[model samples]
Target: MATVHNNSLNRLSAGGLLISLGIIFGDIGTSPLYVFKAIFNQGTVTPDLVIGAISCVFWTLTLQTTIKYVLITLNADNKGEGGILSLYSLVRRRAKWLIIPAIVGASTLLADGMITPAITISSAVEGLAIHNPAFPTVPVVVLIISLLFVIQRFGTSIVGRVFGPLMLVWFSTIGILGFAYIDKAPEVIKALNPYYAIHTIVHYPNALFIIGAIFLCTTGAEALYSDMGHCGKSNIRVSWIFVKLCLILNYFGQGAWLITHQGNVLGENNPFYAIMPDWFLFYGIIIATVAAIIASQAMISGSYTLISEAVRLNIWPKVTIRYPSDQKGQLYVPSINLILFIGCMLIIFVFRKSSNMEAAYGLAINLTFLSTTILVIYFMLRKRIHKLWIVLFALIYFTVEITFLVGNGVKIGHGGWLTLLLALTIFIVMYAWYTARKIKNRHVKFDDIKKYYPIISELSEDETVPTFASQLVYLTSANNKEEIETKVIYSILNKKPKRADVYWIVHVDVMDTPHARDYTVNQLIPGKLIRIDFKLGFREEQKISLLLRKVIEDMVSKGEIDITSQYKTLKKYHIPGDFNFVVLEKVFTKTSELNWPERIVMELYKILKNFSLSEEKGFGLDSSFVTLERVPLNIPNTGNLQLRRVK
Candidate 1:
């Protein structure tokens, strides 16, 4: 499936290019609305300052977006999928500590999701102030954002159809608007020179802060790489040429306008709008708002995909995932949507203006870029590329990303702390969930299943014992084919002696590749005892009930096993036996000993578990035939008791 998809992606068409414009470039494509506004806000505008900032924007897009991501990082895809997690999956086995970078990158990317909508929408709406100066944009911005998030449950198929065309109009409009002013001050073209970029960094006032503002130009570059799987590498690469050209035209146009009014502080007038004629101002504002909403929608959808992958990878707790439409990969996560909505609302109420939100933006995403650089280095190493090329790659990207990180770091005191705090909170949750699972698995005791086969077989044939069901199924975590968890055995024999006609154990293994699905069966005791191992890709859904039924149908068709009722009366009619599923739910007991850090981790994990989906729901099992079994994790140690029993 992945191969076919990638092959199709390689063949580009007009529709593919349009979809790329809509989905892949929405974030960065909307940057012109605020990138110049942000840079000019730093200090007074001058010819040198204007030229240097535009130069920095040009090179930043080239190095960060074009070279690093489009050329290099996109090649690290995992089964035709691209993202930080997809990249991590390709090289996770090489180093266990790589999880740290993955967690940090993923968490920060989410933070970017929340802040992007706030800034983009606010910036677009702020344009209304030009006409009346007293027009309240906050309420309008809030209303637009609220509406965008509210419609998520209904799916974006209808609105999504127009995204590509609308964005096409948007890019063309901005390109024309920017091109109009370039001839007025044709000297602005010199900003494309690298010497000006160096001059601005060396001699400009508050150069780090200026670089931070420049960082916003390519903030959506990460999204460009992430959406690679959606519209094929060919489409994105081809469409980016036009997108980049439009963006540079707009930036240089803004620079031209600034140079004409050099040494003047830009207060109430925004260069993005000033470049437009007064007659087109109203329509331009409308276009900008629509573009902002489209950008926000893209971010919201990407957030859902990100959280879904995290849950499947076990780095995030399982949450309720809803398929709002039949469109592939169109999912709505209620919990995430609510969280992001509230975050955006809070940012609007607090910051109250796009300029204020700008300080909070770019900081978290800078960390994400840094994390990607680190992960990509390891990816290059695993591919067995020459070490010299690896070192050079490391030196260039590491230096560039680290410089951006430091630049954005200055925003920490000014509204940037909000995003940093949000990222930190998300990181804690991911760490606690991942580490707690490790701690729990460390003490899990597995018993060899061969020893239990005799008793299981005997119980299946015992006439004295009442049959619990015709078939009994248990979900196991044991990776070894010959071993099963002791808790599973306890549930079968010691807990209540669950007698049945046949016993089945099923194990699910999440593979490193995306979209893989295959299963194998091991018949330990022929028809009486069977084990099924399912290998599913990280992106695949875990619908065990449906999968189990299909596996049984295959086995029955091949004459490998009989699923017909063993009861004499039902057997005569050839009726299928009812199967009962038992799902083991682990709970921490008070008897378990742990250090302070471990205890803190467990406490956090418990809190997160309370909000997560139940084991049955997470695995997509039917609740009607499923039973929940609470098993104590880290079984009590009697030897460590301090008091002796009274005689």
Candidate 2:
């Protein structure tokens, strides 16, 4: 068995710009499809409204996406990786209370993935309605989304290659189309000035509500920031120059078109498609649909990555993850895919048209952005930046994002509650899981291994005891190599007096780095007792069966303990020794005492525990050779008289 797992993210190159184009820009790239329509949907199209909205869109992208995420937050990388969790890893030790925001941010990001595909793709598909107002796009949207989810099991390794070029074409064509319409309403360019954004907020009626629609322009910036590791900060930063230009150019062109029409009410025709020339209409619609599909795929993949990281951190229940494409960080989670599919389908059915989804769109992501802002501020503080500068950064971002949150808050009555509910559910689960872990840790007691060493060695050679196997391996949670769990000691010496030629303890330590993998071995007792500690990155998967075999092979090469079967007949034939793994499964014992908070959290943890992957499966151990032992959680003391013989 070979033991190598490298999750090195796709790094920078000439093509790096393209992969960044395809992956990083998916959610934001497709924003042009519905942003203008959303702006016009809430009210009439007038000069102040149009210009003010475009100005808001311009600066929002600049300050939020450009200044905050691209320029500043991108600097907060963990081993070239960037995300809410990755960001938290930088400052978690500095402030333990910070985990709450990280949890909320990750939860909201997960919620955003479910709605992003529904809204972005639906908006593009809805473009066909311009040609024939009667076109039913819901069914088409459903089919496209369904197909996207269906293919996830196979992995995105093969299809991911083309994502970059297709996105480049997407940005280029849309940029040109927007440019073509610029001359028609050149005056809209004045809207880029900040005064218009402020003036609209100061004077426009129900301006805050309308700002909700403007907020759509920068929703993808968060997702882009999360995907930084895939293409590296350099690639993303470089690509965004072109990508931002294209986005801004197209946005200005749409503004130009809206200003030219100058009707009291903009009709059902979308400004995104309306800007397209009659000759290019068919091609434009096709291109838009394809871009939407790519964006949807990126969102689905991001969701999988988010949950996978959460599982590694124990903030989420463990679930089976598959490497469909084996392209570095690419992964497929069947359960998450199904959940997102159902959620997307439900949104499609409930909202029906892309127009109705605007209210539901930006609500949850605002929380995500706000959460990231909080985390980033703390992260900057830890870097020992000047207090004055940190204050300024926090003030600027909080003002921008808090305003967006307020704007998006108005959407709640209309449809925002849907995403909020989903986000809340996810947040509770994460918080509960994380909190329960802290509770469980408080009760975990480890005993020094020195006292048990002699006993373990004696048992290894006990002739009267039955041999469990040639080797007995135990997976331990004890962080110190010099310590062992009492339950494991009980199983070995007192429970059954089982024996083996050698005892091995394996401890896996999940590291903060994204792709790290290394192991250290300690021989507490030469030829009889050994410990192997595996240090794995959060992004890497664990396959103990294969890894253990590799360890054994290496040890044999170094002339460590032999693994040959001891029986003379088998030894003569050169048969390999048998290895047995013992797993300790914990359950909350009724004998334990706890407060309401602890009890509730533990019970919820237990309920969620059932949904998680089994210990053997999660560790990637071969279950056939594994025997699970149920151990009661720490219990309160029973008085000595309780054991007295009854008269």
Candidate 3:
């Protein structure tokens, strides 16, 4: 059961609520930094456009973020765990095609992971350049993002406590500033009317295109649901009330400021900072920078959880994971960390400003939103929820998201392609890894254990065969105790004729539950052959060596087996016997008989296998006492060639 675990689903409390604010709201909370500016960037800032844009922001947040995600999607938690993957796990058995949406949604969320930090930090740091155009904010952005990544190894347990208070101050400041300005232009409140949202689309020249920026205001909504398990639904739902209020107040404040400057172009000047009184500018930038960093932290943490689950589900290549703290779901993957750092640096180096990075941002996450929508609808259907609401949910989200997708599509050449490209790359890897596993299992031959029991038992007592180890163990993928891989049989009898006092077969079954840990043991032979099936949750790490050792200790205490060394002197001294593990490594040999698709899958599987963690480390086996055996996965003589008998 050892791995990074998140207990965010523990209970409803003040601490949880605060953590929810600090963590769950970072993405959406920081959006005021750039969302309004992106809308104005598309064209001239007219009163109608400003009013329509603010209206779109309000309604979009209401419909997209609040209703769709916080209210509906958050209900589909996997054992109180929420995320696209978690939701998929709840109903994946309902249909095979569901895997597609799961993979695509998860990939896009990860893509969002890359772009969010770049844009959030870039937006915050851009405030410095706002005051002094000569200020070098690029290096500052790089430095802040770099420091965040560097600290992941230490864990966020210590700093996470302050995220809530920090965000509290940020929201309070934004709300106060916005409320203060609301008096300047009370007419801006008219934008909250849904009519203004519809009017913007009809009257604004680039209204449809502005949906891209509108999508940004709620980009973090999915993340909110994703982290629901970390912060109980009650905590999230409660904190959201405050978070949304402040966010709306700030958006309205910024709107109030924007409408005043109508017909006057605010080029390269952010309304968020512009709306702030001059005295508070420095302090405001400081608070925004801190909030942005925290936002980036939450996103990065979410990425780790996403990839960790992907690995456990066998959809992604295995990588080394380190638990930097006892906190649930706190894991550090060096590979992903480095990849994100490089990606962020690339975004900073290429996009150069928050506005440019914004162009690359919301495009991929819209795909994520749509993907989650499909899963959520199916999940509701499975729960026997009324069909009427399901259809309504689907229609409303599809209409809004498709419009946003098309709007973001216009940014394809303007850096949007970057995130889409990264997401597609991740999707391919996941698809390839998933399909290759199925293909590999398709050709594997599982033999009846009864047929081999006699051979195995006979060979165990045969003194002529060399003693392999006192206790010989093999990890098996077979779910049935009556079956074993034929390769294991051949390795035991034909390869080196390994003989041992007792043979142990271990099978691990990954359950869908987040933290389940139940196991069953079968004693096929009282003193010679034994089988163990461990049922672990996908979130649980497989520490086979340690677990097996504990199993042996329990057995020894019960006098089930004598594991003392076979040597006379050692047995006299009561020295414990040695245990050795045999790990099977597959080597695929491409034959001409393989079809193109099969070959492609096998080739990719091999390439991925090369980069993936080795079976020894992935399974948490003790390398010092393990032996690696390579087996050829060659098709058994597909005699398709018509040849003369040359011999």
Candidate 4:
């Protein structure tokens, strides 16, 4: 599997890699805005504290970001796909224990998706105040958010194209600024050493005021794993080498600028913008704003993809999925967009400034980062990828990450609770949905085709039902007996006697991997009605219509079902008559026999059924040729009695 997967490394192109870097690296790229400012503002630190803090940031990026993410997590990709859900899908069977971490990581990622844009964009907008203190922050923040929502409808391709160049400029600008400051305080360069990091922590005891402050440098490191499909592992690996170098240089420059000026302009607030010359402030604001928007774009795009993956895996409720491009992984989900919009607006309204939002920001990113670390450990152990190396690396990185998380955890009383609360809520809903779906599916008797076959066979003969009815297809579960029963009931109730013709219960099983084209079909119950079930491989995204067409063609070629029978008119040599679809909707009761949580989940699932793709579409039935007969079953109690039907 590793050898087969490694083949994708050859497919990475220069242009694609650059775009991936631009999109995937945006979060970490913009970290300089608040990371340094947060650390130096209120945190207790002696003169040597700068060196130690910078040392921790450097090493954290090396061990946590570069080593854990770029090296280890990226290797856990499921067929070139990476993300919390993707990782979960791959290892869920082998390392079921890791599912907890996967869920936490994914939930936190969603939380980051909501708060990142709010914080990043606000930080950039706050840069505007540098140009003109009179610039109203709240209105500008609202306007930028409104425009972001407006453009999301069109999709991000156009915006993505601009990201690369803008980020390039931002990096270059920071690089130049760092170099200018490096000329004056070259001694600050010593901070990159590990000794400095330890010295600052030990010598300057107060330096621990906000331990979570270091979280800024490593915030988006998870992107290395989350976006493996969009940007190949090698691309992120290579791009980060340069990105990290540039960032370190900039941080060092900021350190130098502060040391030389002795924090003269710091004024207990944003020294990031304050350090720059007045002439460059306007350009810096523009650059920062663009960087913020790009960071927000990455968050939005990543969230859409994550939710889409979740839906495919049945961890999330079915939502409308739109592919704006033929590009493999691109997707747009509307519900997520609206939710993010509301959350972001509220954050801006409440926080009002980027500095305040900082307290709330790192919580989600750190949580997500820690979750990924735990999963990566399991991933490595499962693959036998050097146990000692994996354990040692995970222990060191986890300790550092948890230390930062503690700081962010402290802010929970402030605004950090919002992210954690939202994450937990989403996690519960998603986990409940997945658990309920599994339990309901488990109880379903998929093999009961015997009970359904008779009904389907009878339906074929009924002249009163629909004159155009010829081809009858029942969508059933995998179990043969249950499918037969479902077929029989429909045939008996709808059709009169029974027509001599081909009938079958077709079951479509969706796979985890995308673009899965292969399937298996069974011809059970012989001539009158066949129970055909398709077991799709993980890589295939199942479409019932495509699979059915294939099944029909295969059967016709084998002389099992006549190819010449007219679908609309029954003829012995033609393909059998018009198609009729029968779908069995899962009925739920408030007082179901299942546990309370399961019952509640089923109720929600029932509501969601209405919004799911119609049976006609799901079963590959043509709009003009399909008729639906919905069967409602009673919710069983201790006694079997038909109560008044409730709508």
TM-score of 2: 0.96
lDDT of 1 by residue, 127-174 (tens): 999989899999999899999999998888777778889999999999
Query: In the order shown, what is each candidate's alpha-carbon RMSD?
Result: 1.9, 2.7, 2.1, 4.7
Model 4: per-residue Cα lDDT at residue 138: 82
lDDT of each: 0.89, 0.85, 0.85, 0.70
The TM-score, computed over Cα atoms with residue i paired to residue i, of candidate 3 is 0.96
Worst 10 residues of 4 by lDDT: 1-10
Better of 1 and 4 by lDDT: 1
**Candidate No. with top lDDT:** 1
* Per-residue C-alpha lDDT of model 3 across residues 306-347, encoded as one tens digit per residue: 888888888999999998878767778888898788877877
Judge candidate 4 at residue 60 and give its lDDT. Answer: 79
For TM-score, the strongest prediction is 1
| Shift in Å, residue 324, candidate 1 | 1.3
| Model 4 local distance difference test score | 0.70
Worst 10 residues of 3 by lDDT: 1-10
